[model samples]
Target: MKMFLSHLDSPLGTMLLVTDDRQVVRALDFADHKAHLHRGLREHYGEVVLAEILPPVGIVGALVRYFAGELEALNELPTQTAGSDLQRRVWGALRRIPAGSTTTYGKLAKELGFDDPRAAIDIGAANGANPVAIIVPCHRVIGSNGDLKGYAWGLHRKRWLLEHEKAMKPAKEEGRTAMLPGF
Candidate 1:
């Protein structure tokens, strides 16, 4: 598979954006998560040949606006991801998680029609397997107890993204809604 790879500047860090011939986003990840990104690409599209080039203008604009605090900026952006039936369903559900809000793994599993308690494990795994980062909104998922969980990118990045989306209060504020950094 052939794709265009471009680097875009964000407040958190440089982000890698991959787009297809139609300019639809194929994948996106932080520059720091290069390995995760590559693994995702290889799984979704075997033998990907990435060419250094600019991403779609509309996609870049949306990300710019998203980082600038416009939470709805990504709502209309188009993306295509390849995964199994359940994985695809889980990824689609992740997108429905509102930007300034969050859902728990167990809760997400239940919402997806899974009554078994262990479904949270599957949900968590699917969330980890998500190829698209912010656009898919996987960062909005938290533990059932409302504690932060592992992010493929890192816990810090997840917390930062939640704070950026106002889903969680900043680490500095002393409030029940806030999570202290390094905790």
Candidate 2:
């Protein structure tokens, strides 16, 4: 198992993007979270090999467009991820959440037809385990109280993504907000 790793500059921050030989994204994590990314890779594909290389041009271009305000650029990009059935389902549901909208874990569980009270917690776990980031749109899911919650990357990145997509208003001088360009 050889995976290509590349650095991508985004409005939020530098990201470590990994892609399989087929150019399908395996994981996309913040450069600052390098340890977490490597740990996830080891967990997902035990004893793997990583090589430094440029990511597929198409994927990079799409992400560049996305950060440039073409929000739908990633809608059709191809992605392949490895996870349990529940995690896969949660990721699929995440992709269905339109760019400018959001959902809570509770509502997502209901959509999956889970009536158990703990479904949200389970779903949150799966969401946290998502390998690919923006492509899976995991940031689109928020707390039931309409407040931002845990984002493996960082709350500031989550807030930036939501704000970039216009799903959330830029935090009102909350200090956690990223000083976005083109403001």
Candidate 3:
């Protein structure tokens, strides 16, 4: 398996891109070094894909396009993601969250037809486990209190993603738009 990292210019600052020979495995908010990010990759991919070698810049380019709102669906880039069946369900649900929109965990739980918040919390855990970042749009899920919470990358990046999507979403009517808690 091939592995590499690249610097991406984004509204959230420089981000790290990690990929295997087939598809992207991880995209992280910038860190001083790659060592801190290797544990997860090592656990997920074994020794096949190591972080010592940074991935090609093109991998990062795709992410840049995504964050810029130039690319809508992210099935183009290859991603080798592993998760439980329930987690997969949650991830799939997350993809349907529209651009410039936010959904509460409780609401998502209801949409999933579960009356309990624990089920939604399970989905949230899976969302947090997601290796492919912005593409899956896990950042779209927020606390029922309307606060951003529990982003593996960091809360700042989560806030940035939400604001970025809000900025990208087209205006619906004149002088009137959906307002978010922090945006």
lDDT of each: 0.88, 0.89, 0.66
Task: Give the per-residue lDDT of model 3 (tens digit) for 103-161.
Answer: 87778778878888787777677778776677777888998877777988777667667
Candidate 2 local lDDT, 72-118, one digit each (tens): 99997877887788988999899899999999999999999899968
User: Given candidate 2, what's the lDDT at residue 26?
Assistant: 88
Better of 2 and 3 by lDDT: 2
What value of lDDT does candidate 3 attain over all alpha carbons? Answer: 0.66
Name the regions of candidate 1 deviating beyond 4 angstroms: 173-183
The best candidate in terms of lDDT: 2
Q: Clashes per prediction?
A: 0, 0, 5
Which structure is stronger by TM-score: 1 or 2? 2
Predicted candidate 1 versus true structure: per-residue lDDT over 39-155, tens digit per residue:
889988999999999767899889889988999999899889999888899999998988899999999999999999999999999999988889999999999888999998788
Best by TM-score: 2
The regions of model 2 sitting more than 4 angstroms off are 174-183
Give the Å error, residue 52, model 2. Answer: 0.9
Ranking by lDDT: 2, 1, 3
